[model samples]
Target: MVDTATNRVALVTGGSGGIGRVVSERLARDGMAVAVHYAGNEAGADEVVGGIASAGGRAMTVGGDVADERAMAEAFDAVEQGFGGVDVVVHTAGRMVLGPLTDFDLDDLDGMIRTNIRGTFVVDQLAARRVREGGAIVNFSSSVVKLAMPTYAPYAATKGAVDAVGLILARELRGRDITVNAVAPGPTATPLFLDGKDEETIGHLSKMAPLERLGTPDDVAEAVAFLAGPARWVNGQVVYANGGIV
Candidate 1:
């Protein structure tokens, strides 16, 4: 068990990306020492870590494929060594390949399954074992899982599995004093979400939310901050950050 008095630590996978980057910084601002993990974008991860440091917060950078057990094990080891032990794990690493089911490439589907499904399992399994008592594990799902949007079948399938993992793991950790939950964000204005879209589609999605705007990375990050930091009772559930898109 980690000493409750020390600074809490967090390992955020995909800390280089849109939503993940914001989460890494937010956790740092909340006073946890953060390990910003990136699979490919080392520069982005560096920027996040540097910004945190600039803000007088504690942070470091680690890198690995979320699907690789050995790589992730090393990532965890580094964070444990750097900050005593991990208290929160907010897994935001994922892949998104949007297209209609009829024309979807089998290989694309396989890739999403690899990163989104298997990657989630690998990370969660480790968190279940390594996270300290009173720790939290937060995974990323998607609003598409609830929206049932077109061209999102493959992606949503992966997140549905994430939802399953969070719920079951919360039960599996029955008395461990840990909470597990998934955050499902709708139509966030991230590079990943905006990459191939046209203006019309973007406008439609923005309006789908009663807020009449797209969700920002910060918007979703607030939800994550609540789950990872002080929401001890919010376990085994999917928290929707979709701005009332339903």
Candidate 2:
């Protein structure tokens, strides 16, 4: 009972904000029906869905904690019921906490692991099953995994795990014609980057890269689009969209 005219469908977890928002909207504009997945930001997700629909693209918002299996299942069901099976899945939902290893709070570690690692596992498992053949899976890793920044040990650990999981997933899906890849972004100009930092600190961090500026959500989205669309031969690789901040 789905609309066969739109063969491309996408589920963008955390699509309510920042890089997720931009990426989801970009995919919709590219002619994919997008499911804007959000944890607790129903209004934000709705805004993204509304924007896409207003622009003559098909989109809908579904709310759930990405780390929760039951919640994620419901979200996926909404997508399947609303727009048929998924063709692409972009996992942009993750938790980022900063602390040195010595000072790493177990609670923070637990939360981040659940959201970043467990959440990705659940989403990827379902997406890999639901997405049609020749579809693409994009998971979010972090530049911190390569940069090894101080106070980001715990956060980086989670992303490092993401990198490994994504690569192995690519191999597991062999012959299915599905590609699994990870996008590791450096300090980008997203709300997550601005949360607790002042202007001067942010500027310094931005200049740390050779590009002399922080990345934009659109910049990351472009990389995701390439992997999702035409980079069929690219599989099991972490495309660092960090503007050379490695």
Candidate 3:
């Protein structure tokens, strides 16, 4: 509800991490003032903000637990005060625990749910209330939901909820001139995705996509940029940026 008619601003949660970093950079490059959000990664967030400033783009670092309402609300207020208003919100901070549903530890499942499910709800609730008209809301999902791969049930379950959030919120925001969508990425080559995988497993996954390669952060960021900035007609959709893996 803040006045943001003159400049576009974007607040990207998890902006210090892999996919989020690239998305923040892409949005900044597109002429939007970017708020780089972090959770216990203020240093990383600062680095992102520095890079954006070096590139002559406007950006700042914001920190909060995505599932904590008070902290996130303060973060949102910081951005609105710093950059006029928030026009786009990208929730990319998520927890991924790959284990068979039956064998998964209850504590682990609870942790994942807190971060992935409740976190999404907290962010979306604030975004729906605060984002200026014509803004976009993007929640990150995984292609695993459709692939139905083994040992991915726990993680996919969380992303399934993400998909639902995007769909329902889009409809709920009717006539707000905003676009709500989810981006489902396939296996991407990032530090987070490559940390524990061996070369063989990486090779196998790379071949899963018809494009014969892993998806890049830029590949996913391009989809986000289009939706957040220019794709006004595209709304209430789950756009898969998985190189046709789904």
lDDT values for all models? 0.93, 0.90, 0.92
Q: Compared with the true structure, what per-residue lDDT tens digits does model 3 show for residues 78-190?
A: 99999988899999999888888777898988999999999999999999999988899999999998999999988899899999988999999999998899999999999
Lowest summed lDDT window (length 10), candidate 2? 1-10
Give the clashing residue pairs of candidate 3, or none: none
- Minimal lDDT window, size 10, model 3: 1-10
Q: Give the TM-score comparing model 3 with the true structure, all chains together.
A: 0.97
Q: For candidate 3, what is the total of clashing residue pairs?
A: 0
Q: Which stretches of model 2 miss by more than 4 angstroms? A: 1-6
TM-score of each: 0.97, 0.96, 0.97
lDDT of 1 by residue, 1-246 (tens): 443323789999999879999999888888889999999999999999999999999999999999999999999999999888899999999998888999999999999999999999999999999999999999999989988988899999999999998899999999899999999999899987898889999999889988899999999999999999878889999999999988
Among these predictions, the greatest lDDT belongs to 1
Runs of candidate 1 with Cα error greater than 4 angstroms are 1-6
What range of 10 consecutive residues in model 1 has the weakest lDDT sum? 1-10
Q: In model 3, which runs have C-alpha deviations exceeding 4 angstroms?
A: 1-6
